[model samples]
Target: QQQVRQSPQSLTVWEGGTTVLTCSYEDSTFNYFPWYQQFPGEGPALLISILSVSDKKEDGRFTTFFNKREKKLSLHIIDSQPGDSATYFCAASMSNYNVLYFGSGTKLTVEP
Candidate 1:
């Protein structure tokens, strides 16, 4: 009942375009939200994320829109660029201190 599914194994965009990534889960009990961004051969870093109680979260050029009732969420990359090219993973947990169950991740590439 605690599974997160991601889509678009990979995607490409322009240097200054937009990129959208998605994630879905079955468990509504999972409240913690943490999106991680990973570069090639590197570990993921904590990106912007939203709690189940909130509808949105943003940091810099990244944003996360969450729909708790739907058990779904998405990440929108504004002004996507080559530096933003990385693997984005969606994860959830019951609490911030708990371990997060991460999605396989969506590979995004922004060409200049």
Candidate 2:
């Protein structure tokens, strides 16, 4: 069973636009959420994250929103650039554990 579910397997966004990737989880025990960004031939890197207690978090062009009540979360990238083209993954984990459950990922293409 997939614990985390991500939508829109692929997405295309124009430069300077905003790209949104969303995910939902079945586990209410998940206390930490992180969104990872990966480029071709490279490992995924932590882009941004939010804890269960936080409703939203922001870092430069990236932002993450958590909705614990709905068991959902979303990552937003503003001013999307060509370099931002990559696979975005949403992951969840319990605060006490190091294990992470990842979604299928959303491949974002930023068109210049």
Candidate 3:
């Protein structure tokens, strides 16, 4: 069974607008949340991450808001741009485990 889940299978936004992707997990043991961005024909790259102890994390235009109590989180992309269009994946893993459970990615398109 998949422990991580993402919503809105796909999304489209205009340049300069912001987009939000929601994710949830079933495993309470998962404490580390990482968001990855993938471009066509390329492997996913680590975008940003947050620990269970953190309520929020931000890096430049990307931010992740986590709710440990609810085992849910959301990634926000600010100042959306055409170059930012890609498949965004939210993943979770246990502190001691190397395996990461990834949610169904949200394909985002930033139209100019």
Candidate 4:
């Protein structure tokens, strides 16, 4: 079974600080990696993603560092703000597989 795991299930950061979330997966067949952010009563929204062929992907203040060999990845949130508080889920899927395996999630709180 494909499984994804995340550490420090919850995190707290001061505004303007950086937040880091760690995630790991079991399946080597997984190719696509995506991170989603969900707020109360709202569906998750894609934050950033990276391919197996890529080691790092960044957009604005969000960055995903991937390690294909170890089947691990880390999501970094820079310049954190109070509005950034949310639950983040790390997910992985294969190009041919329609299912996405997601980590438990990391709830982040940014203190202003």
What lDDT score goes with residue 60 in model 2? 99
lDDT of candidate 1 over 1-112, digit per residue (tens): 4399998889999988989999999877899778899998888999887888899988888889999888889999999989888999999888746778999899899999
Clashes of each: 0, 0, 0, 0
In the range 35-64, model 3's lDDT, one tens digit per residue, is: 999999999999999999999999999999
Candidate 4 global TM-score: 0.97
Computed on alpha carbons, the lDDT of every model, listed in order, comes to: 0.89, 0.95, 0.95, 0.94
Q: Where does candidate 4 stray beyond 4 Å?
A: none
Expressed as tens digits, the lDDT of each residue in 46-100 for candidate 2 is 9988999999999999999999889999999999999999999999999999999
Residue 46 lDDT in model 1? Answer: 91
TM-score of each: 0.93, 0.98, 0.98, 0.97
Which residues of candidate 1, in runs, are more than 4 Å off? Answer: none
Cα lDDT of model 4 by residue, 1-112, tens digit: 5399998799999999999999999888999999999999999999999999999999999999999888899999999999999999999999898888899999999999
Give the local distance difference test score of model 1.
Answer: 0.89
Q: Kindly report which residue pairs in candidate 3 clash with one another.
A: none
Model 2 stretches astray by more than 4 angstroms? none
lDDT of 3: 0.95
